[model samples]
Target chain A: MKGMSIIVKKVAQLISGLIFLYGIYIITHGHLTPGGGFAGGAIIAGAYILNILAFGSDAMNLKNKEQGSSLSESLAIFIVLMLAVFALFIGSKIFFANYLPKGQLGEIISAGAIPLYNIFIGIEVAAAIITIFLALVIFKEEVKK
Target chain B: MNSLIPLFVIVPLATSFLIMILGKFINGFQKTITPLVLLFLTVLSFYCLLNNHSNSYTYAIGGWEPIDNIPIAIYFVMDGFSLILLCIISLIGFLASVYSISYIAKFTSENNFYSLLCLMITGMSGVVLSGDLFNLFVFLEISVISSYALVAFGTEKEELEASFKYQVLGGIASFIILFAIGLIYWRTKTLNIADISALFHSHETSTFDLFIQILLISGFGLKAAMMPFHAWLPDAHSSAPSPISAMLSGVLIKAVGIYVIIRLFFTMFIVSEEISLLITTLGTISMVIGVLLAIGQWDIKRLLAYHSISQMGYVVLSIGIGLVLLARGVKPTVATLAIAGGLFHMVNHAVFKGLLFLNAGAIEHRINTRNLKEMGGLSKHMPVTSGTSFIASMAISGIPPFNGFFSKLIIIIAAVQAKFYLVAFLAVFVSVITLASFLKFQRYAFYNKSEHRSTSKIKEVPFPMLFSMIVMGILCLAFSLLAFPGIREQILGPAIDVLTNPNQYVQTIIGI
Candidate 1:
């Protein structure tokens, strides 16, 4: 599909970076705040989707990135699972045990393993949403072809 | 020992992700990885069964133990009942995965198939092991969603239509289950099964409680494909690939549907005579109607799908009889026998029906058609498939010396001893009709002469398919020995004990 008007593309370019940054902030601070991996990842995916809408699918190279997105999504999930499994191996011999040292309560990294889980989940969810979106786009293009 | 509970969910989930990620780059990663994961699960499940036969333990995730005697974390409850389900899931899952090694070669994106299969296994294991009601709901959704995708994996027009129907019906079942969980949490103020049972024991029943009971039965009934809610089975099971059909019919429905119903009704809710009768009536209708429908089917898979409903009927009917006896506080020994019979039939159906579906797949793989009318004289060319399928058919029909016969005999004897003459009669009648329909299946599919010249070129299926079928066929005979008292007490006794005594379940889990 073709790109939107130049004005729309320019505005999306300006805002997408901010959106992406905000999503990262939300993910990192998830343990201390309300928004966690799912919410932040969705926001980040929304940013990329917005860019695709304004810049067009070809310009964004979404078709090429689909495989990468899927791979990363799977990797993210694997990492989250490994974190839990590793805790079982190292800490209390229990699944999902918090083996990391607990920092001060108000700090961003205070909760042992929670922030790490959130970060992995964020990457996974974002990649998953992007994969789904790209798949739909590719399917539409195929039908047109 | 409690630590092992999470492995059931973790192993499958992690392996699924790994296969999806790594299989994308590696040519045959899914083929090797999927079977290994399932084999590991099968061995682990059997190990759990042997070690935990006399003990039941609960694992609290993240060490979120209860405060003030109320469990706050997601608990994984492991008992004889869940272990029985675990064995069935892993065993059938392994065979189905092995079968898929060759069968799925025709489908594109083999990695996606294996990944989805692993995810489905994770969901089923999670459902069977989770102690919290909402956790069960979550896992149920996971399983059902994966299954919807798997059912449509073939991408045929009919496959898509069947998957759409399955998703809609399954979605409604999930919603109803969620709504019931909400009502339950509202009433008892706890999500843990043991805690809820304890709360219900201390309080008097209200109208809302009965409403919740009905809701749960209908909700889980749809998943289990109880008589009224079974419309999706014929289409969905027949349209999916053969191994998938086996998984759906053999283990999936039992794990998500019948298993949940039995666990919730027997342990969570106080059983009453009226509810017990309701369940039995549902079972009887499904038994009779399911077989009647099967007798007229021309498609091989469709015929087997109908029988799934019929066989599930026997299980629910026997268990219903047991519940009725328990509710009325009569014939405790008879009640135990009835429930044991139900459980035994459940395992037997998993083996034989799984084999039957695999047999159908083998035939379809060779002949490239599902029509019974189009097939004939196949036993000559495919001795292994025909031989194994014949054993499965006889076992399912309750012929003597096979597993089905022993389980059915127990149900019948239990029914007679309890003076439920009507149930006993129907059980025997259904067995006869089952035998008749299967005879038709054999005559038309394998024994009858074919007019079509294509039968001459038909050959046996690949080694993986043949191997799975043989394993399931052996299980059909081996599981019959559960009737012998020495083995029965070890495998089936603990499961029967947990169900018969609900109070013990609460005390064991809650340590009260």
Candidate 2:
């Protein structure tokens, strides 16, 4: 139930917000950048994981609380599915049709639906990683007890 | 018509996520929604199958048109062969879902089980429908991964152990398959199955092609649980929940393993006599070995699981017979018969094996034991389960008037006519052994007098479970109609044609 030293805790809190912001940067510019959803999502998950390690298990509960990580994970993927299904409803009904207009190449929103997909997938991946991490933590705790 | 293909994968996938989200707020949402979605899929698949009987239909995901006669799109093909598999996936999935409604009540995480089941369906649909090799691999993992979780749903000692073993073997299979696909992509510079076949033909046969072929056979062989690579079947199938065992036995192996082998070998690769011979040899060995293993099992579900391996052998062997004959370019009619019988047996196995497992589940539900020695004289208490299981056992044993007999009959006739007298004899011999084993199962589980446990207090499983078993029971008899010439031609004919003439597939897909 205890956490690490004060130095680690102070450093983790300092960098966590910066890491979260960087993850957003990577996800938002996924159309023009190398990192996209999966990589960016991993980095964001790393931020949360760092905070959890520095703070204790009780600092944040990640599964099945009020709109917890598990629920958010499910909700995120459901929205992504709806977006894909949205493509079918709009056009001659293609399942993954990029129905929206393309702004321009190399822009933040160039690819019509790719950025949107990347953002949602990033959320899903991030939430999913934390959820799995928290589950292992709880299991380890229960085993110790 | 082709456009509807994506819905098969999409609807189940969406339903899976939808279940987890709404299951938190709504009571019984997972139970109600899962069966209805699968039912909708079953109707959709049959409708599409009848509408486009002869020709293959292709859909380009994202509507990406072919670039200068080269396919740049992620393609999905729905021909007669895949359509048959689609029907199997949805039909079995629906029945399993309905059965799970009652059966899964004991499990605390009911929502997780249903979600995983739907995801499994989505993956199988994508596997059969996809026209790209890499895409199929992705879908294969999706389904198998879901199965790994489902098998471990109980989280008990045996269940965890079985899932671990299944995962290790399954991981190796996926690695081998992905390596093969990587080779295909490297060699042909395309992932489209139709284009790969077309490109393969334009070039002379090389050792590289043979290497990839061997890799694919071994890789998918592991997935199919062929003779040599079948250690995972009994443990994984027996340890899992009954509905999952039914799905894994009935649909998962066929759609992900045998169906892919049939599709890739028939349509995607030029027929090689030696490879086909190897396949047939594997089939025969698995047939004898699987049944031999089954006869000694005390656990009813484990016994049924071993029988799955044996029955799959019939399918692989017959398909191999067709492949060898086609490569030899002689007696096309006989090869057609062999394949027709194979495909027919696959369908019959799905129905009857699924029913048998459900019966085993029902028995286990009433009495807390799967060991046949622990059970006795339950025929009076659970008439529906015992009666249906009798039909299932008789059908699987190839008795007359059941669908299994007809399919096995066709396979043996074709084998004999093709001058493979040994195959014909072994096949018949195996059927007799299967009969003995099932009879033993019936005797001990239902008719035998047991001194150990009193059976007076045991009640039948609830309605939902019985309903699924009864429907599958009727299907065991009803599918015998498929053995008739008129109906056989209508149902099995197109599937046979697809395998016989591979060029039609490439032509249809590539617009040659």
Candidate 3:
């Protein structure tokens, strides 16, 4: 029974990992196409939810989840703020100006600051989604209590 | 002087994270620390508003400059309008935090409640201060998501259902808003609101204009909980913890919904007869329907929730009247008076409605029941809560000697002045209905005789909660004094000036 449980947990973890990666792909390609931070982040959070359902809350070793997620959100916010600040030194007249040269439309370098913002947004959103879900899971009333 | 611009968002965001850290270490830091931080932030925002000479200030995050006269960076823009909103956000946020100190203690894991509360504040403050359309959308999402989570904080079956409904509807709104932004970018190739406004001003009318306007109105209308798109409001507002309900109904909807709509209408879109008419009609419908539905509700919070929709209708109707008058090039003063009345009521509603929810929570806290029929004759036991609720009820019902009276008076006056006599009559009729409904609320919740009359086993809530209610109650009386010419001249007038003349806002910030 122990071996079977371990195998099931490993399979859930693997599947969740793949799903997380796919969410990242969607977020990165958001500005170029359709999917964006909110959709991708929700998808990633869905993966975590699936893993928790399969393995139970105690099976996974998530570190300081609140602090971890909050730091991630803060870092994403910092990046957005920094990008806007970077515009100041470059002589842009206002904040968040697309200082980088627009390479070409439909290419990786196009859309100026749009992709950068999408990435930051993706990080913030993913962290927030995960945080709320984790809070709900942790705060659940024990069934037999 | 201009440096204080970022504090509006930063203070709440930082305090939220700080509370999370402190909450883990101390036994009751979640209860104590969160309220202190909120109080400090509220005072700080007020100080900033008072000290600043310029009506508008723009803070570039990390010092980003615009390229080629195009704004690409995120800007935290503060003006008289934003300051008015910021004051509402911080004050209500602080009071909610204070009330939550006691109210949330009934639940386990107090940290989560405080954390989510702060997140909501952060989102709201950011929405008020944001200068760009996309940034506003982002902040709005943050607020909506946190609120959805907070609504389900109770973890009851109904709470879950309500959150789910709110999320689905709110998600659709966000999607529409995002698509609208994409369309605008596709046409204008810029995300900055100012640049978009400037672009539209320089060019002639375009085909995509109406589409953008409709999309934005629908999106914000959903957030604002306007009449046609208000299906999710009663459930979400009633299901959340009372303080959270207060936050949702009092200021959150206005900040994220109506404020954005007004800003965009004035700044980006040219005032047109069709849009104005649509807005007015919708406002009138929401006003009538929201109150009519509210009268039937016996669940105290649910009734209050529906009233929020009703009150918001008055706001929209007044603003719509103003916009219609302005578009027709009629009496500009009448239009200003109309918008001023709307804005004034917005502030008044935030205080009284928020206080009312806190009062409801107080009753619930002592008796552990939300059903009004189950509550009775507890006024002697919970005097502070009852007295404050009386004050809040009076204020909400548009009784004289309170903030609600002045604004409603102004709105009625403006309607009559603008020859919108029918609208004026409807406005008075709704106020009467609002009064009648709350009288029922008072009779049932506090004054009605019940078998549990001697069940005076309940004591008043804790100091923090009572203190917040008292302060808000005091403000309810004090704010009415703004109707006096001198006080109005000092605060409301300047704020009204900023809205009426959009150029003053841009010029003050850009120093053009």
Candidate 4:
């Protein structure tokens, strides 16, 4: 449960922000690029996991963060589901219809609702992985106790 | 009409997430919202049934309709078969949720339980409604994962062990299914069931197709817990909470396992005589062996779990016979009868088996025991549980005037008409053995004097549990009216029609 060597901790702190930024970049470019929500979310989770590895459990208060992450994950999934349901109400189209206007091709804001869906999935997947990681950490701590 | 298809999956999925988010802060929100969502789904499914009226339709999600006669979007197909499955899932889901309102009180983290339950429902509804094979796999994972968590919810040593076994087997089953899906996609260049069916129909059958079929049967057979692939079911069903056990035995296996097998074999792939015989042989083995195993069990829930395999065997056997007759080009009417028999038995099993598990839960809730040897004279103190359990027991045993008898009779008559005389004999024989086992259940649990002296504090379960059991008990008798021609035409006829004509299914979707 102790923090890693001071050198390792300093290095992790210096690089974790870049990892977070890269994850955001992948999520935003999801509609036009190869790495979408799942890959990007995993990268985001990895950054947080790195922070935990360097700073120790007490530094992040992982138990409380896990609760927050789980709630956010649920909220993200809700947003995704609501987007689909919103289709049914707005137009004569079927469920998950691309009701939003197609802005353009090969752009961040294009492809109707695809980017929006990707962002929601990104949030959900990121939060879910972090929660799982924190839960395992908490479980191990409890067992040690 | 096409627009309504998504609600089956959406309502449960949305409610699940909502419950998880809000349930922590809002005391008792999980209990209230879970039942309300399921009840709404029940009404919606019945609405779907009434409106469908022998018609089949497909909804293209994201409005990406077919291009140049090839489907490019994910499709949700609602036909007689899916609609029937939808009704079963929703009705049982509603009843189980109601039962859980009281039953789940003993467990902490009620929010987690409700969330997982809703997710399971969403998975099942999605499985039945999906027109794409890959989408089916996704939903199947959703349900299976939640169920694994549910099975281990109690966190007892036995529950954890059972859940571990379930997860390993379930994982392998998913892998096999995914491998087979890869083969299918490799061959047909499509994931849509209707598109794949059309493609297969135009070309002559290949040995690779047969290979894929074998993989599919084994994979789905594992999920269905057929005789050869039934190791996880007894442990998983018995170790879980009673309401969960009811859901697993009543609808989950039928929804994800048997239902998928029936849909794929009948509608997606070409049914051949050899395949039909293979399926029938498996069904018969499960039927005989499952009951044989049940008779020796002391744990009431474990005994009922074994019978789930046996009753599911009855369903698969009848349907297999129907397939054989259809494949052999003989006795079309008799084949239709066989299919109808199977479908009716399926619905009947869901009702009675669900009631039985709920009964088991009620007894356990009151007495804190699952061993029949420890329970006795419960008919005096808990009249509702005892009476409802009796009705369920009689119904499952194929006693006359109950729903089970009519469906069993139809199956036997159909078997005889189809000239499978041995099958008819075995069907009747299994019914008898089933009766004997239930009599044992009745005697030990309700009739005999208590072997232990701690029976002083036993009482009836709470009102919600009692209410659900009573409703299911009434349905046990009510569903028997399906034996009539007028009723059969409305409820089971279209489903049989859809199964009998695979070409019709393809055409309905592709409009060719």
In terms of DockQ, the best-performing candidate is 1
Better of 1 and 4 by lDDT: 1
Clashes of 2: 0
Model 3 achieves a DockQ score of 0.14
The candidates, ranked best first by DockQ, are 1, 4, 2, 3
Q: List the residue pairs that clash in candidate 1.
A: none
**Angstrom error at residue B307, model 1:** 0.2
Q: Score the docking of each candidate (DockQ).
A: 0.87, 0.83, 0.14, 0.86
- What shift in Å separates residue B472 of candidate 3 from its native position after superposition? 1.1
On lDDT, the candidate that comes out on top is: 1
What is the docking quality class of candidate 2? Answer: high
- In angstroms and one decimal each, the interface RMSD of every candidate reads 0.7, 0.9, 5.4, 1.1
Model 2: per-residue Cα lDDT over B206-233, one tens digit each:
8999999999999999999999999999
Name the runs in model 2 displaced over 4 angstroms. A62-67
Q: What is the lDDT of residue B357 in candidate 2?
A: 93
Instruction: Give the candidates in order of lDDT, highest first.
Output: 1, 2, 4, 3
lDDT accuracy of residue B508 in candidate 3 = 42
Q: What local lDDT score does residue B138 receive in model 2, on the 0 to 100 scale?
A: 95
Off by over 4 Å in 1: none
lDDT of 1 by residue, A1-145 (tens): 8899999999999999999999999999999889999999999999999999898877866677998899999999999999999988886778888999989998986888899999999999999999999999999888999
Q: Is candidate 1 or candidate 3 better by DockQ?
A: 1
Q: Is the docking of candidate 4 incorrect, acceptable, medium or high quality?
A: high
Clashes of 4: 0
